[model samples]
Target chain A: MSSVYVHFFSVSLDGFGTGEGLSREEPFGHAGERLHEWIFVTRGWKEGGSGGVDDAFVQRHDMGIGAEIMGAGKFGYPGWENDPDWKGWWGPNPPFHTPTFVLTHHTRPSIEMEGGTTFHFRDTSPAEALEEARAAAGGQHIRIGGGAKTIRSFLAERLIDHMHVAVVPILLGRGERLWDGQEGLERDYAIESVSSPSGVTHLTFTRR
Target chain B: MSSVYVHFFSVSLDGFGTGEGLSREEPFGHAGERLHEWIFVTRGWKEGGSGGVDDAFVQRHDMGIGAEIMGAGKFGYPGWENDPDWKGWWGPNPPFHTPTFVLTHHTRPSIEMEGGTTFHFRDTSPAEALEEARAAAGGQHIRIGGGAKTIRSFLAERLIDHMHVAVVPILLGRGERLWDGQEGLERDYAIESVSSPSGVTHLTFTRR
Candidate 1:
């Protein structure tokens, strides 16, 4: 069976996946790029960057990922659905080179982008969305791409099989938190943690 | 000037310092010692236990601390004030071998315990309480013992000079959160993290 995975998802020390006021101009809102600065300094993001533990873990983001299911918040900015020509934050060739399903209320026609990435809109439950993404996964693993709420919903339902969360040391006082309603999440998964030299702790949770 | 420190403060992965339904029987509430199980097996707590990273950190709880200022919640149960005979959760010889100040709206006369630990109740702000604890500290650092709200208040005022938080990899869906309203706290502190082999990440914050 193909595993459901969440890789390299970053959250602030206070558990905020994204900061307040997320807009097209500031995709991460008040958090800015602080939540993901650990990745920016890794060899996976830039050449000649540190290829230490952080790079070792971040570089695994694309391994065996066949399809992705992301929230509407991650598909684009807050009012992105109103704009007809908004492709995505990622330029022409997005990092996700798979059939990416965007969970949105306003379902639009599928837009095929360059580099094997196709945006498919779906307004459905997490279980339903996972089933659809599973069918499109072609026997490979499915990646649960998040802006925070999407991952929390899947976690609440115990859908994720493997997850890697990079906990940034900074605190984004106010924003959408990732662990709000996940009370007994530890019951289903065996968790492990490792801190990096860049001051971020990588947490991996594998289903028991 | 004496520095204020918070040592061996434990919180769930979701940032809950203590669980819900806090009462006399369930001191940590539904958390039920879950948040503190890491220290229970440490050599600091037991005679024959692991003396690794977790033990090394837990043993520092009383290091160089002349006085302690804790919240009312940490001192006793919710309605302990109503009962005139209520002393504290700890036995006659409490772990704190110094003058400990309890911040409570219902102030009481000082109680001298078996050990050097003397309970002094004060209804004052975090700064004023620190001033009293500082004087009582006799040039040694003052410890900010917590139950979450007290530590958050001290942190909000930037009164704590150092903090060591043990992040346990469990989610207590509902409880008192430690990180709420503490946005951009990293600006005031230099933070570092180390993941212990026993599955807890120890985070140390030094005032910048």
Candidate 2:
């Protein structure tokens, strides 16, 4: 079955998926590369890196994903919309080889970048966006790529079937938090945790 | 050396130490026993319980500790001060066998309970209260007994030397959170994580 899920999403111990003051120069803002340091050192990232448990998890980002739903921030920096030449953060060939939907207030025409990825912009609610992405997904699973707000919206509407959150051991105290207004959300899911030797804990929430 | 630390403090994956609407009947509030089920099944808590890593960690609550600093909410329900006869939620023999300081504006006389635990009320800052607790510790160690707010205050001031936060699998979307205004709090400490088989990840932070 085609499932809607999130994988390899890294967050700080304080629940921040990303930090404040985001820009083109600092994609993760003051958080820099700290939240993703665990994945960056994995064998999937470097040729000579250790292929341990961290690498084993990082290798699942692309699994069976046929489509992706991302927020505007993930597509580009804050004001990238004004720059007509802004294709995306990914130079020519993006990481996602599937159809990607970018949720934003200002809609734009679909831009087919290099490789098999295409960026489709839309100004709609999470449910509406999911409907479009799911169709584009064919029979494969849909991955929720986030800047935190996008993920929260999907969770609020109870659309996520599975989620994997990597909790890095840093304190990015003042940023986009992932747990606000989510009281009693655990009732619908069975959550489990696994701590890696690299000092990060992976929390997996599978819908019950 | 005698250190200032926190031990066996359980929090949800969202970083909440205690839930909303804490009362005498529901000490952990809406969270109920879900946040502490990991410790309750430990050998240190009950007879014939599991004596693995979880129990090994739970048994350290009273080891090498002399005094404690807690928030008013942890001492009793919200309006506990109105009832002068209210000793505490811990009954006659409270678990704490040391001089415990309760931070509150309504100062009251010290009440010496059974098991050598004394409840002392004081309206002071974290530094001032820690100084008194350290003295009462008698050169042993001081444990930070919390209700989330007290621990946040201590963290804001960098007064803690060691901390062990158990990340339980459940999510208390609405409650007193443990991380806020603590940006870059991890810089001063070396952090590590270990996931127990009981579905709780223990996070330890030691001063660098």
DockQ, prediction 2: 0.81
- Candidate 1 has which clashing residue pairs, if any? A173-B183, A183-B173
lDDT string for model 1 (B1-208, tens) is: 7889999899999999999999999999999999889999999999999999999998887668899999999999899989898889899999888999999999989999997999999999999999999899999989999979999999999999999999999999888999999887888999999999999999999999
By summed lDDT, the worst window of 10 consecutive residues in model 2 chain A runs over: A178-187
Candidate 1 contains a number of clashing pairs equal to: 2
Model 1's i-RMS, to one decimal, reads: 0.7
TM-score, second chain, candidate 1: 0.97
TM-score of each: 0.98, 0.96
DockQ of each: 0.91, 0.81
Off by over 4 Å in 2: none
Clashing pairs in 2: none
Q: How accurate locally is residue A46 in candidate 2, as Cα lDDT from 0 to 100?
A: 86
lDDT of 2 by residue, A70-169 (tens): 9998889889989888988888899888899999888889999888899999999999988988899988999999978889899988999999989999
